[model samples]
Target: MIEDRELQLLINDIFEYYGYDFSGYSRASFKRRVDRLYQMDGFSSFPEFLSRVRVDEAYFSRMIEEITVNVTEMFRDPAFYAVLRNEIIPVLATKPFIRIWHAGCSTGEEVYSMAILLKEANLLHKSLIYATDINTNVLDTAKSGVFPLRMMKTYSENYVAAGGREDFSNYYIANYGIAKFSSELSERMVFSQHNLVSDRSFNEFDIILCRNVLIYFDKDLQDRALHLFDDSLATLGYLALGTKETIKFSKMQEQYEQLRKEKIWKKIR
Candidate 1:
């Protein structure tokens, strides 16, 4: 286990060595991840681990990737997507152009899922899905629109639960050990590396889904991210969070209206 003082030293060192900021993230999560890396690398001492992080750029990249490894899937919460498919899409469809940002998009499962939703709604022609993650490796995975073939069964089940009617297999071509989604869906997606902690809003969006990402941040960092989302969202746009996330007590509660059944908020003010 990484001691609190040692963790602070690492956080400071990482920020000074690399521009990435982990200071705002949850200490427990950071310590756990860093400790896992330390053990995996067979470091005998904290000094040795810190030195490896500081001196070897490649090891640092590996550390970032391991520390921020994201676990995500398509239509993660069926009811959430059901709400979007049945209610949210209609409202977004009225817009001249739909801009959706998948902030902290791990490996693009949800991004591709959104594209499928737009395609089903007959609005894919004008919808642009911008998917961003802090980790470049994951961004590259998302850019390729490929996922493990074994996971398709689970994703297909999620698709149906999310109100999808078409045979989900039609959306992708599976071969060997991977599934590659259609180019039609990928055509409208733009993938990039974006750091939610320090990066400012790039464009106004009708819908911004940062799902399952904010829970890892501390209260102040959560507020900062919510503020960024508020700035980036359009006047009547929606902000979606993970099932465990909420804005009820935060500063965003006054500006956004929460949905009755989901973790989504509409920017009314």
Candidate 2:
């Protein structure tokens, strides 16, 4: 609803008021999301939205949901999971215990995906998955592990392509147009709210999967996140990203070896 500079001021106000920093997000996509929020809320100007945000905490929560990207599904990018199952899990299985961080895990689909893979490999019982998201609402959703049954068909296709050996339907029970994934898959998973932009790394992980999340960030924020991952990972730990996201030009690129078409990388230095 206004020039980019004015919109940036609004973003700054949000940071000052709520401690949620969005200034490092990609400008074009951020503006588009903000514009959609403004239009949907019937705000006449950016200041109007800013005024509401400063005064209303709930409004700020809604803004965070709108501004942050959350597009995800079960076993997204099947080939990536295939590579992980074929090339990575075996190595991790040798560890006495495993710590996996699913950063930016929106609604927990892929967390469950990894859990299932670990279970099949006889590694789930000894593995701990820290699934974190910036938004608590989605973290709650992920905790519940319920999704629309209509999505099962698509997810099932992805499951097979990802080298699933059993019927995908076995993982969930269907009722009332929704499917609730088995709690067995969630037993070892911990879902929490974590801000990759500002939060410090909490644990050294054997594997970190942060797919499709950084494309929304500006270069500086992306580098900040990459550095965080670098610090959080154990030597020779794995880093998995979205297909479109890469470490090729990152300052830490040389510290990693790209594996399986760049969808996965291993920290070498």
Candidate 3:
């Protein structure tokens, strides 16, 4: 096992060399993932792994995929979506045009879910969903709007629980063990690479859903991310977070009002 200080230095070196910053992530999680990568790659020492990462661009990409967490599903924590349906979407409908930012939208499941929700609400044409993540590969998968057919059953259940009005199957076509969603759902969407740790806010938004992405970040980085969200959101805009994430400890806590049981906050200040 690499010593703690040495491992941290290696992480910093990757940031300096590759412009990929993981310093603000939880050290324990970073260590665990790095250790797993070391074992899986059969590197005799940590330094050997570092050497491969520094020189081999392909290996560095593989290393990033290993270290970053991207666990997500369609309509995850369905209650949250239900809240959005019953409460949030109605107010958003009042707007002439709605802009939703799905920060760290891994593989675009939730983005599609939001698009489907807006479609059912008769607001899809008036809305644009910007889905972003640090991983370009996942963004490519998201842009493709295709998923394994086997996961459809569960995703369908989640859709129903999230107050979906139509047959969930109406959203996609299944063939050869793959499901391709309708292009209509993807037409008003844009997928891009965005690193929360380093990227500045590009546009103001009415709603930002950054679910299940911040639990990996430590305090300072979490605060930095929250500030970025703050800067990106318009006044009275909605901000939704993962079930495990909270804004109570954040510097911007007082700037928002908890609007729903889920971690949905509205910027008031």
Candidate 4:
């Protein structure tokens, strides 16, 4: 069994070594993930586990990937895309140039979804997307824009339901049971590694999509992230979140009006 004090030391060591702060993450989830790592590595004690992780860079990278959850899909929660297409794009169409940010974009599915949507709407040429995540492994996967071809049938249905005009097959080439998305879609996007917990905001955006990534954080961390979004958004800029996540309890709630239940919010000032 790993002692609490030893767990703290491990956490501190990770932060000091990698500059990735897991300190603000939920303790229960963090501990559960670490425990799983211990069992997988056959370590009976936390100290031994910590020493092994510290000494092995590849193992440490793998452990970070294990600890950071990266679950996403193309056109996830179709309704949110529906809302964006119906409610947001019309307004965005009026802008001369648009800058959108995808914070904590796991494997780039959502980023590709947005890019396809913008292209279909005839707005892709005018749009610049910044897709960021703390996990470099996931970011690299996202940059590849390759996904399981078996999943495309379901994704195609989502695309249509979200008001897609063209055939979904137009977006990618299918080869050996994998779908490789077109470079055209990726050309408009800049995928990079960014830690929302420790890094400051980089650019003001017309729209920010940070879905399903905040639930792992505590309220204080959530609030801090929201504040960063608030600062990074232009006046009346749009904010999108996961179905279960919301700014309702944050200090920024009053400053942004709920555009689509808890799915989207628009900064008022």
**What is candidate 3's TM-score against the reference?**
0.98
Per-residue lDDT of 166 in model 3: 87
Tell me each candidate's RMSD, in Å, in order: 0.9, 1.0, 1.0, 1.2
Give per-residue CA lDDT, model 2, range 1-269, as digits (tens).
66889888988887898898888989999999888988999988667778998999888888888877888988888888888899899999889999999999988888999999999999999999999999888888899999999999999999899999899899999999999999998999999999999999999999999999999999999999999999999999999998789887889988889885757899998
Determine which window of 10 residues in candidate 1 has minimal summed lDDT: 252-261
The best candidate in terms of lDDT:
1
Descending-lDDT candidate ranking: 1, 3, 2, 4
Return the number of clashes found in candidate 2: 0
Q: Model 3, residue 61: displacement in angstroms?
A: 1.0
Overall lDDT per candidate, in order of appearance: 0.93, 0.91, 0.91, 0.90
TM-score of each: 0.98, 0.97, 0.98, 0.97
What TM value does model 1 have?
0.98
Which ranges of candidate 4 are over 4 A from the true structure? none
lDDT of 1 by residue, 1-269 (tens): 77899999999999899888999999888889999988888888999989989999988989989999599999899999999999999999999999999999999999999999999999999999999999998888999989999999999999999999999999999999999999999999999888998899999999999998899999999999999999999999999999999988987799888889699999998
> Which lDDT tens digits does candidate 3 get at residues 30-88?
89988888888899977787889889988888887878888888988899999999899
lDDT of 3 at 80: 93
Candidate 2 segments whose C-alpha is farther than 4 A from its true place:
none
Stretches of candidate 1 above 4 Å error? none
